[model samples]
Target chain A: MSLRRRDFLKLTAAGPVAFAAAATLPTSAHASPAPDNAFDDAYGVLVDTTFCIGCRKCEWGCNEANDVPRRARTEFDDKSVTTVHRRPDATAYTVVNQIAAPPETPQPVYAKVQCMHCNHPACASACIVGALRKQPEGPVTYDAWKCIGCRYCMVACPFQIPGYEYAKALQPRVMKCGFCAERIIKEGRKPACVENCPNEALTFGRRRELRSLAHQKAVASPGRYLDHLYGETEVGGTSWLYLTGVDFARADLPPLGSRPVPELTEKIQHGVFKNFVPPLALFGLLGLVMASQHSGENGGK
Target chain B: MSPTFRRLAWGIVVLSALHAPALRAQKVQTEAEQRSHMEMMKLDCRQCHTCESPTTTTPCLMACPRLTVAQSSGKHVVSEAPESMVLDKLADQYQGVQFDHKLHAGMAEMNTSCSTCHHFCPPGKIPACVSCHSIEANEQNLRQPSLKGAYHRQCMNCHREWSHDTDCNVCHLPVGKYAQAHDKTDPTDIMGKAHPVVVAPKMKSYVTPYAKGPVVTFYHEEHIELFGLRCVDCHQKENCSYCHDLSKPQAQKKTMEQVHSLCSSCHQNAKCSKCHDTVERPAFSHASTGWSVGRFHSRLECRACHPTGKRISKVNRDCTSCHGGWNQSNFRHAVTGLQLDETHASAECADCHENRHYNLKPTCAGCHDDKRDFKAVPPGKYVTVSRKR
Candidate 1:
């Protein structure tokens, strides 16, 4: 009797509404107010693979800038590492892979790979505790404080980015390129990799301008380029774009359809969790049945 | 002036003014001027300037054209260019680059001349890289690389060939660390250093994919010393990667056109057997033809007599071995400086000498029983009256 029927009904009705509001909070709190796939003003990078000489100078600069375990600048002269292709891992946020090119190419094409920084990141969508986030300016960031070691974002990324620190006995971070978000957003400077590139292979600018620049590059040199800008329309677009001389797959970038990965799963799967509505409805039905039984027992008595 | 005269004068002025610029634009260049301009390349001005009238101030220039005519390099000589230049325009983190201009220009003679580095330069003057490649990259014109990028691309195109070592210390010393080193002895340090002699291989034997006689022996020394061919004449547009690539296999895949391009420049009409033979061909020798270019002909170039091409020395040949047109009547004695006497001139030709053996001195045993002292007493008096020979 102390748990009154009116109070319980009110609680059930109000709970789901509050939960729905909280579930939608992350997008408004962190992401750009712009509609999906339209981050025209957001920062972006254009990677021209043809200009990369596999110098590894950018890698040295990045490691030093990010406060990772770094070697002397002169040690980057060991270009033998370029002979073997590599992907970004926990230690390094960005890596340049010397991939096979057409036989006519004088040197093998080098691919600089990092997080694509997707416009609508599936990693952020899949993050259960809201640790992973897509910032308004262009970076898809991660907060270790809220991560809870779920590793769901790892499975969610289309680029196969976001490596985890399994070796650490204590707290391990879900590591990936931060897009030098602090430097870019706060200091208004270029990313260390872009600044250090000898050939200016990595050009940074507004995402919209970069798309046009990539298009112009292909158009200007029709023979030099493949006429396609990867990450432009792939997976609803990305902050990082690539102008490749060869096929995108040859550069280690998988050909993804325009429709985002999260679009397939979010509506149904996330809809169930968005509000406490489904659980509340299920319990409300059960509550109604139990109450009816109790009232029937009282009449029988 | 009459009214009609005034009208005609106005019309003439207007017509000339309208056609003035058009005439200049379509002015036919001379053979020399056209030669300097690579035969007036890029006739369509739109390739360089986007607009109709590109002004000096606004020059709405596109980036350096893709097919930048390197032919203008002929206008530049090593003496006319700067000896050395300290490029400090954009130097910030590192010290200014000590570019050995004369050294590089000297090296350019072996490559495509000054155009090897200075790919685009208009007539009359050579503008510095900063003239076209501005401080920042032209966002509109992605074709022109930024100043920093331009400098790096020019240097690294060759240095990058090392594959392992594009070590910045080779060119860029830490600012304070290097400036003092150069201050001590500025002239001699890398700034004014000359290009080291490129030690070329004596010969290169190519086992080509040709079905008929595959070995193509190129005698590098013979081509240089005997044939008198300059390095640039043959090694045009040589690829640095072709020499520096360490990972590539021994037998690189060159197309048939590419493999033959170097030899075809001089050996255009040469038979395949001249180059491609079962065994390496011996160095060319005039002695093999029973004419040793020994003492008198040693200084003569092969082309002095041979003249190259399909017709081998048929016309414009220097030697005087054949005088088929010469006869007793047409022959002039004073020119040879032994004017014949009346009796000697009246005698039948070949009475004392063979028909074609006029170079030989003959005996006078046929007419006068005396010594054949033609120079002193027998023939005619010398024209100049001195025993010069």
Candidate 2:
């Protein structure tokens, strides 16, 4: 009985050890089926901060377009709102924040904070049930019906852009700037904020061309703009880009690296569950050991 | 191909055609050369005219000249420009801007000329802003600013430097509603605001920071009236923002170095006391130096007698200092209202001018026994001459 017990322990330990080793190998049997979203001709917006007048009309336009509650037209004229820095919230999809500049300069820097609509959004990667999807057409779209209300997406967003409808007791959903995806992708119209801009500071075009345009503008007017383009490679490049006169850090725009956010987590998770081979091997060995042990016991009887 | 792709190709051809002149610009007249010729006439009729004289009816207009964008302004005086212009092309939400055309053109003359705003034009013509900049932004060409952007950029470039006011009401009155209810009789209701005509100061006195001497008096008119300094000689260094910056309502205090920089070109080697004093100094006078610059000398420029260098050397009280070269042959004594007789004509200058002191009256007692004065019994007959005080 002691010898049989030792044999059972050896078999069980060896099975798991072999299974663990197999998981480390790159699996050909269970290749990921996630759609390739590295699109080249995706639409984007180029924001020239040098031209922005900080009118806050873009905020009003965003509210009107996204079905968010809007105030009277005159409300946007109240520039005192810029006295305090603001963030995009559940009620509003975009907010223009006034950055402090040298008092002598006539042009004041304003940053329009919104969802970056990253090519590889961490929010979509964090969503366990696929409620948030990085659409091939260049938007991280959310489906409220499919959402389990896990709220992981909110925590995972690098820009802290995702907002949860915590006020709603039922049918609460995650909200963010959808980049006016329906208008841009389907109807082929400019985003409401871009259309409403009096200065035409926001330019909507192809991502590749805009990238070149942003660089060209910076190079052409070296004194007017800093060399840095904020979203060119941040989290593998966002659909929206910024051209700022001030330093990116001073403009409230953080510099993130070129690596995609999903690359690391996908590798680790995909490795463990690849082909379900690890679980199968461990269970198959356990059943065989128990049957052999039972037959030995019967013989002993 | 898609319609959009075809349109892009067409746009490329159009843009290339617009800039085609730039490629063959070797034979084109340089801007400075054009300006030199244009300076002779206020209006650049020469750009279009093949003949020297262009009449009202027969301008003698040449074939359209090959002109570059830069040399096209051919800037003229403010009088040639319209006093005011009504810009109504893009006026949708606001009233047409009643732009004081002459006022802006006048200001531009102080620094850059018409080329500052009139960036694009034919060789002789001053085209409207709408001529080149399209109503809609050119999607195919990113360099070309739309009409709206061009208008705002031109105004805001300089206005923002001084006023820093991007408010719509600054330039445009609202079109509809209570906004159009302007009072016609009210003085403030006048459209096309004008800069108050600047009255040049005669003099300016300041109590400066110098410990030894505080008061500094500047003779503003005398520099131009007496010294013959043009306004551009000193005014060229400073820009409009020096006085017009609204954010800084009060003019800034300057350091000694900063103050001297403005006057350094002329007063490079001047002493501190030359400008600064414990009390405000009076305007300069030759009388104070014990030598009166008489009517004839007063008409002459200060540089004519004084050394035109770092320091102005004083004229010696003795007449010989400047008139040393003058002798019997060159003196031409007839200028003194006396035509010398045969006897005195051959006499040495010292015979009448004792000790060569020409300031003193001539002494006749040296030759004549009878006591005769030069005023009564003259050496020669008096001739009518323009020898008046």
Candidate 3:
């Protein structure tokens, strides 16, 4: 009878062990489906740098949408404003830097640098406070209340975007280009930057659609541009992709490979941590043996 | 002695013996000792360090006897140092142009060299300036840039002098103060180069009040008309900082009055007609202007609401942009801290209070005109109404 009882316990332990093994496997055969999320919507943008004239209309739209503070002690109507090239600030959520090309065939390339809203956002993983999170609708967004203002997200970000408000003494916030996550993802509309771009330089759509459009634009313009689509496979995939007429190297953008940043780090972490399962199984077996041994000892007494 | 002690002694003896020769040779190096001993032979300095013009023959390879051997033997001598032969040929063929080594070295310090002006001809050949200059203006090297590109790249790139004219005549003039002897055909233009605004003009500064240092002499006048900066071009309140809050004295004290004066001086006068269409001359007469400084609050443009030409004028200051006939329905009362509490006697007046006009019933009689028989409860007269839901 004791041997039979031991067999039953063994079966119970084997069942869980098999299940845990399957869980660690690459295929998610028995795993639960991914949670329904707005980010699952998979929206993106096609930024053709060739078309951008650096008009700064999208900048104004972003400022209006996000309520960012203006910096230069002058009004927007002042023409001398565009002379000084601008970068993304706490108030200006998005900025377009003017990159001057060669003199003879001098064409000014305006590169719009903003949040890439990565598919597997490193910012989301780095945020221990859960302030920065990848929303279900495919946009990495910020929750102001949850942020402790550690600014870890800024450092972890490969793009080195995401600015902090130094002046606001009482309640400062981590300001960044959220793909207008609040308006677009929540309200089901295009981002203010995309909608406000006068030259139609910024196009909003899905990641799949953006890839094809970027490819078509690149192929159509021969010798006019570097035949490469930035961000299609960079840092494992970004919602925002760019097509430029000049070499991207000149723009100081990194040559990121296809592997998602978080996956590489998480893979190593899990490899070390997955020892949990074997230890857990041993514990289960030990518990069963101890319980049976104790029961037999009691009966004999 | 023990074995360990004997081993230690042997180790010390061996170390001393091994280092004895080096220790004997060690001595402080005198300045005379540092001088090149090759001076005893009086060999030409240019033998190793060849300096040559960037013409057909590189400065280093000029009159170099080893160059022939180097070429035949297939040993590589890659350098731009002027060759003694090239210098001799230049002295004979070309006039004595005091090739200022000091100036050229100074220019080279600011502007990078070594690989820029010269190249090692592959298959063991010396690269010359003419090698690059031989290729005519094409897609690769735009037509405007000539061999003068080398000269200009040196001049314009290393030009730390910002106060003077950056024209070619400043440095390379045939008759100018720094002009060398007899290459009157303008050696500055050697390789047929044209200067195309070599150095970018320094930008003008715009004056700002808050700036602690020199006033930012912003070149507004040039950029506006020339760059076609439109009315809405830079009015971007997002990119600039120039607002002043005069309501709170302590907070307002630190605020520069120049911010108000400079901004209002330009903005008030720029397009006043666009804001105030109600009156022709913006009525100087106080009574003719039906607009009250303390009434009719709205998020109207500054020019629209503040019609008075005076520096300071009283205007309704409130968070009633929506309530004052401007149907900003998107605006939330909750944003202004105006959430109503129970008892309906107004939970906190100052919390939602503003200097702007609002149709809030100031007294109980205002709302309950007939219910309270048009009588208002005076100050200190407390009234409470409780209803069980």
Candidate 4:
């Protein structure tokens, strides 16, 4: 009875704690102490939902600016709100969302949705051929010929701006909004939509200027603004910024802080895989030991 | 035994003597027979020849009856070589063709003989095309390809394609004359009198054989102003063959009147006064009727003078055809305040007027800055400003 009890105690003591330590041994042996930095100038947009007016003037301007085909119904005089608002389709680079009208206010508030060309844009990073690239000024441009329609960019984009032409039998190209990059940068011309707006609503200027303008407009009009410049700090900064007077949370703008998106995943990834150095060193040591043991066995045989 | 042997020997000697001349004659006969035997028919050699020559004429010929008939048929056969039994055997292994008869015969003018294009055997026998056109092909005949390749080479070759002539009158007429001013090489002009072409007895059936004359008058001057016929209406500036054959009709199925009726059916409503108006017709309310036709002559009606919409012969370069007399001219309006300088006059008027639509306002504001919208603006200048601000 005494001998059996001693054997049982010894078995219990040797089991769990030793196994648990072995499980965590490799991780402790090669811990990455440094944080990674792949996102140099990753840019993005923060759409504040509070200040949108559903006037749809932005839509009209966007269509005109992009030289898109005329819609079957575009009567601006009608005030009926539809069950489904507009979406940014193949031709439209931007869309205006019509939120419920403010109390006692006759007109509804609207918000524009377009490419949130991201800082550390997944689309640019995913492009194997370097077809999609985020420029320093915040617009992502594409080289048509280099794209082979692998659709890796489509999967990579958070906003899902890049669309593929599955219907075209030949010579299909990836289509997306380039934020009027050609007109704004090279020709020094305002975007067509910005230029032809009947209302004093749309404006084209430097990103900083736009932020300041949005802030000033909101501050000056006390009841009019929700006191937020959407693209000022969210997801880094976007070339196209927005201003809204409604609750942004209700406007469907995703809640995100100033941290660039790629950093989140890269932090965990680089912490595990540290430039492949630790794993390679361990492999070399194991190989040396295994070789010596194998030779000894072979000699004995 | 000696006597018997002598008799036998004498008999043998007599027999040998008797047969020697006959053998020699036979050998000579055979040589002559080979030379005389009909072996081949060279079709191209007989293109200009009245009839096919017998194969005895050349040792290189492979005698064939089918080739003989084809060779005698004449130069018009498109396949310059004849089809024989040997050719039939080769055709079973490849593609066979009965080429167009007329075009190939046209090469007779080059004075080429059958050997120039045919496959001849060693020591001058007429070999089959397969013998020279196959994997064991010789270099001399290597350039001459298969039957299909040979035909394509001759027909689609760069040298044989028709192209536009760049000579002066060949494209544009001389100066102001609307119709072709002259055909320099015309045989009628060389004789100083038009001589009627002799209708060959064989070709008489093809000459003006159908009874039909041009149906529509197609008054050119009337259409230029009335129907608004541009220069391209009937006259094309490039590739004349692109529209009309100009050589000969491929079909005699339709009569001339049928063709004329078919063509003019679409253009029946197109006439003078349809687009332009005479003084008797309804006049435009704001049209300048009294303006002098400067540089353009004024005596004739619009349709009578410029019969064709196209600009015709050379006219005077000075801008005085109608404006020379100024206030005394038939036109009431004259250049009272200012006249266009050489540079302005030469510039196309439509460059500033925008499009050719007659409803155009014809003002500087169409392209240049609008002066009326803003105060303190010059009459002819424009100003750019933001509407929103």
Task: Give the candidate number with the greatest lDDT.
Answer: 1
- iRMS per model, in Å, is 4.2, 5.0, 18.7, 34.7
Instruction: Put the candidates in lDDT order, highest first.
Output: 1, 2, 3, 4
The candidate with the higher lDDT, 1 or 3, is 1
lDDT of each: 0.74, 0.73, 0.53, 0.47
- Name the docking class for model 2: incorrect
- Regions more than 4 Å wrong, model 4: A1-61, A64-83, A101-105, A266-301, B1-389
What ranking emerges by DockQ with the best candidate at the front?
Answer: 1, 2, 3, 4
DockQ of each: 0.23, 0.13, 0.01, 0.00
Clashing pairs in 1: none
Model 3, residue B13: C-alpha shift (Å):
99
lDDT of 1 by residue, A13-64 (tens): 7766555555555644743232245876899899998888778878987988
- Residue B324 of model 3, lDDT score: 52
TM-score of 3: 0.36
lDDT of candidate 3 at residue B216, scale 0 to 100: 40
> Once model 2 is optimally superposed onto the true structure by TM-score, how far is the C-alpha of residue B122 displaced, in angstroms?
8.3
* Candidate 4 CAPRI level: incorrect
lDDT of 2 by residue, A40-133 (tens): 4788788888877777868878877996666665566567687598888888898888887776655567778888888888999999999988
How many Å off is the CA of B125 in candidate 1? 2.0
In the range B1-389, model 3's lDDT, one tens digit per residue, is: 99999999999999999998775554222223223323332334344345532222233443323222221212333233442222111122222233343333322322332222332222235555445443222223221223333333333332312211223233433342224432244454322233232242334443433323334433444334333333334443211012222221243343544444544544565443322233222213234455443322222334454566433355564536434553323333343333233434342342223233344444343344444421243323334332222
